[model samples]
Target: MKFIDEAIIQVVAGKGGDGAASFRREKFIPKGGPSGGDGGHGGSIYAIADRNINTLVDYRFARLHRAKKGENGRGSDCYGKGADDIVLRMPVGTVITNAATGEAVADLERHEQKVLLAKGGAGGLGNLHFKSSTNRAPRQFTFGEPGEELELKLELKVLADVGLLGMPNAGKSTLIRAVSAARPKVADYPFTTMHPNLGMVRVDQNRSFVMADIPGLIEGAAEGAGLGHRFLKHLTRTRLLLHIVDMAPLDENIDPVREAKAIVKELGKYDESLYQKPRWLVLNKVDLLPENEREKICKKFIRSLGWKGKSFTISALSGEGCKALTYAIMEHLEQESGIGNEEQIT
Candidate 1:
């Protein structure tokens, strides 16, 4: 199925049924009181989160949703039947917003989460309700209330434990493929990944974490450069970020250090909190480097940046130095489970 992260839809609740206006005519009684019944309530509209869904592609073609109207009231003091509610199933990490107002309505993060999008109209009163001692033989009846209608914007963000960040063809996809079972399209050209791909990285038999590989980002990604903010939002939910740098770039035009700085700058511009997330640098494509010069280059890179955090060197294609990197990430995640910022990552 095509991955659609954003969509616009209109939702309308059902309208209430009209009240009945009737009087009883008996053979024995000359004039009887009003015997009209009240109307039933209309159906409501609800949006629910389901884990089975990962995109908003279903809403792409069908953008309008409406509930069923209530049945009309009947005579002889009999009420009308209420209409059934309409429920819309969406992805677990969907964020619903009001299109006109630009206000967030709901943020569904867990499975089975539900939110009421539109409320049903109330039922109208019958002529019998207005009948009293002073006002006998009344013929008053009220109409049903109108239901609520709204236009909403739905956006989906992938939920992952780890996120891979780097420029195009920086070995991010290769690293994920080596660790997880996800088979993403791989090519030598830039921008091979159009959308974000999710994979499950198993550290051991019982321990595992979700990883997301988003499209490559350029220098001015925060300002809508290259893939822009569309793909960057997917990284907001990650607990750990792996900054993959191509130690051996096929194109001499790319600079590993400058690329890393540019990605960090973009992150800071998009969200200040993202800059504070736990991040580790990984120099990929170590197999391309000469064995004797690998250690020297690693030390020079670290010294040039004056880095203080952890770092690793690995070749994603050949799986060299991958085992150690994965174990280290698992340990770091365990130690800082609840330490840093608890705000929503994306």
Candidate 2:
């Protein structure tokens, strides 16, 4: 299935049915009394979150959703029939907003979650309601009201326990592949992974967590540079972020410290809250360096970058330090959720 995170659509509710007006005509009686009935209510529109759906491509093509109008009222105290309601199924983690006013209408985080999108108009009154002692034979009746129409914007944000970020070819995808079963495209070129890929990292039989790897980020991403912030929104739902650093670059001219700092700056510019998230450093491609100097190189790089947070040295291609990395991440996640190592979450 295609990955579509955004969509725009229009919804129209069904109109209310008209009221019925009639009078009795008897052979023996000289005058007849009023006998009318009220109209039926209109149909409404609702949206539901389904776990089976993972994309918004269906909504991308079908942009308009309209309900059937209610039946008209008739005579002889007969009320009109109401129209059926319309229900739209969307993916979980979808956020609905009013396109015209830019107001957030709903945030669907759980499966089977439902929310009202449009409201139908009320039914009109009949002549029987106006009949009184002074006016016995009433001929007054009201028409049905129109339904509500609106345009909405839907955006989907993937849910994950951890997110990976770095420059292109920085081993973000390789790290995910080494830890989990997600097999995204691995190439030497930039932007090999166009969309977000999720992986389930099982530290043990009873402990596991979901990880997401998004596209790479470059300098000036907030100013519409290099895929922009289009993929950054996916990381908003993650509890932790792993900032991968290329310990050994193919080009000797590329400064890993400067590149790492630029990526962090771009993140801060794009979103302060995301920048402030619990982020750690993962220095990858350590196999490219000598075995004896690996520790020295990593320490010097961290010192040069002035990073105070936790840092790990791992070779994603050779699976070195990957197990320890996964175990540490699982422990951190459990701590955040207020769970202990002896306690099983599942």
Candidate 3:
């Protein structure tokens, strides 16, 4: 299925049914009373978060959505039938916003979460309701209220525990394939990954975490230099980030340290909070270097970049050091979750 992260659509609630106006009459009775009935309420529109859905492609083409109108009331004191509500199932991480007002209406983070989008119109009053002792023969009725309508913007941000960041063809897709069952398109050219791909990395039989791989970022990515502008939002939901750098650049003249710094700068420019997330540098494609020079090169790069945090050297293609990387991630996540649970209890 094609990946669609954003969509714009219009939603309209059903209109209420009209009230009935009639009078009761008999063969011999000279005076009769009003016997009209009230109208039925209109149908509403609701949105639900569905875990099974990962993309917004369903609402990409077809934009307009409307609920059924209520049935009209009949004479002889017969009430109209109310219309059924319409529910739209969206992805778990979908964010709904009001297009006209530019306000966020809802953020669906959990599965089966429901939110009301549009309210149905109220039913109108009948002539019988206006009849009283003073106005016994009153002929008054109110029209049904109109339903709510609005245009909405739907944005999907993938929910994941770990996110991978790197330059194009920096072995991100390759690493995900080696660690998990997710097999994204792999090639020798740049921009191989046009959309975000998610993979579940299971540390044990019962413990696992979700990982997301977005398109690579180039310099000035925050200024819409490349595809990064389209998918930078996906990184907001990740708890940890793995910054993969090419240890041995295919182009010898390009300095790996400068490239790493450029990537970091782009992150901060795109989102400050996102850039502040816990990130570990992973020097990839180490197999291209000799065994004796691996440590020396890694240390040199780290020192030049003044990186104080944790770092790892691995070959994403050969699966060397991949197990250690994944195990470390599992431990970090476990500790974080444990702390969260304790805070909740307190």
In model 3, pairs of residues that clash are: none
lDDT string for model 3 (1-346, tens) is 9999999999999898888787878788656788778888899999999999999999999799998777777666888888899999999999999999989989999999999999989878778898898988767776677789999999999999999998998999999999999999999888999999999999889889999999999998999998977898999999999999989778889888998999999999999999999999999999999899889989999999999999988899999999999999988887888954675789
Q: Tens digits of per-residue lDDT for model 1 on 74-173?
A: 7889877888999999999999999999999999999999999999888788898999999898889888777899999999999998999889999899
| Minimal lDDT window, size 10, model 3 | 335-344
* Cα lDDT for residue 126, candidate 3: 75
Please give the TM-score that candidate 3 achieves against the real structure: 0.96
Q: State in Å the error of residue 60, model 2.
A: 0.9
lDDT of each prediction vs. the true structure? 0.88, 0.89, 0.91
Q: Locate the minimum summed-lDDT window of 10 residues in model 1.
A: 337-346
The lDDT of model 3 is: 0.91
- 1-346 per-residue lDDT for model 2 (tens digits): 7789999999998888777677877788656777676676678899999999989999999999987767766666777788888999998889999999999999999999999998876667778788899999888888778888999999999989999999988999999999999999999988888888999999999999999998888888878888736889999999999999999989999999999999999989989999999999999999999999999999999999999999999999999999999999999999898897447655
Residue 21, model 2: Cα distance from true site in angstroms: 2.3
